[model samples]
Target: MAERASDVVPSSAATSHSDRGRMNIGQVLDVLRPDFGGITIPKIRFLEDKGLIKPERTPAGYRKFSVADVERLRYILRMQRDHYLPLKVIGEHLEAIDRGLEPPPIEAVVPTVPTVALNSDGLPSAESFARRSDVRLSRRELIKIAEISEELLAQLEQFGLISPRPGTGHYDTDALVIAQTARELADFGFEPRHLRAFKTAADREVGLVEQVVAPLKRGRDSAAQGRVADAVSEIAALSVRLHATLVKNGLHGA
Candidate 1:
């Protein structure tokens, strides 16, 4: 895939403005290195892709950062590290700052996203499991808690990996799980572009599940939907185990 324009940042300009000191991407990283260890060009670009900072462009199309820009980056990194706030919340804070208002405190109103739990018999219960599995997170909360870049989140959504509920604009626990998994993969240098295959495979798997369960769901009886739920849960668990086994075998073969 072609790299996005946001990823190919421009080189810094030679001259600085009289009012504010200007630095290129490298210089900006130097200033932030002490505070944000292991910071990289990609991460900075990711921030820019998320609209966290708006650096000026020189005539050569290089990115030029002012002192304020560096401080803004610091504030965003600090909020994420210190308060576990999501990027959406940080963006709001930045917006408030732009409006000349004090940003709200970092106390998160939404708790961290929850994990799914299986029942005693090693099977997902019809009622309790479905109830517990239903996790609704606002778009901002999903991005913040998942610690994923909005760009990556958008890609995931585009590929149907992390889908928000229809009409509600809120994501469920499955989306959270997918986002969390994607974030972990990103730490190992796997960008969203590389993860499209996983999404495609999952869609295929879901299609297979739907083939079997669609009939059960079509029934008007309440028990029919319950049966469909149970079927999906079983297939979900089996699919996870199968995927893990296949990956393990592939790695060993490699």
Candidate 2:
């Protein structure tokens, strides 16, 4: 597809800018090579063929890429490498940008870690850990982002290590974390079945916390609800720290 005439600067104007600002195909390669080691001239041409980018052409037909074109290529490469997005999806993003609309959010494809502050001892603070994330991922997205196979995800669901939201059928941030962690554990020969004990322990801790918070919830007052939230965060952090310490001591003794 041909680029819009307005998209290309006139040849007369091109010569007026500093030579460093405008780049030929080889110069574009040199600029992008440090960050994208695999980029090649043919790759750039392929993107043009797909109509994802359109560098201007000189009278002799040599491709003349503007700085904007180079940045557009960078965005395309980053989406492909970091998010595993296909060319079709990247094209949609570029179209959105061209139309002056915000690109669709990618949180579903790349779940963001919740912002959390740490304590003086380098452990996450209670309030920080309590911050809820609204990120929701489809089953396929979860598998791709976590780099796990369908079989592993099914096994995780079977063993109760990760699950979708109750009704929406979308996995949340917690599920994403569990899935990624399970994938890493598989490297050490740990299977989903072996993680059942962890689920059981977590349930026990949750139950204990619920018992303490139940009274505050019963009050149903705004102040009571606030207290309940604070209590849960504090208790959860303490429980995690205690669990970690016990495991460390046991490993040292062994």
User: Which candidate should be chosen as best, given lDDT against the real structure?
Assistant: 2
**For residues 1-254, what per-residue lDDT tens digits would candidate 1 score against the true structure?**
21111222222322233144678899887777876897888988999999999999999999988767777787787778767778998887676455333454455433443335655654444444346444467788788878888898998887667787888887877788789989999889987778888777878988988898888888988798778888887777677667777988999999
Q: lDDT of each structure?
A: 0.71, 0.77
Residue 1 alpha-carbon offset, candidate 1, angstroms: 49
Judged by whole-model lDDT over C-alpha atoms, candidate 2 comes out at 0.77
**Largest TM-score belongs to which candidate?**
2
Clashing pairs in 1: 86-144
Q: lDDT (0-100) at residue 244 of candidate 2?
A: 81
Model 2 Cα lDDT, one tens digit per residue, 1-254:
21221333333333333255668888777777887899999999999999998999889998888867877887888788877789988886677456433355564433233333578886667976688766566787689878999999999999988889898887877788889989999999999999999999999999999998898889856788788889999999998889888998999999
Q: Alpha-carbon error at 44 in model 1, in Å?
A: 50
Q: After superposing candidate 2, which stretches have Cα over 4 Å from the reference? A: 1-123
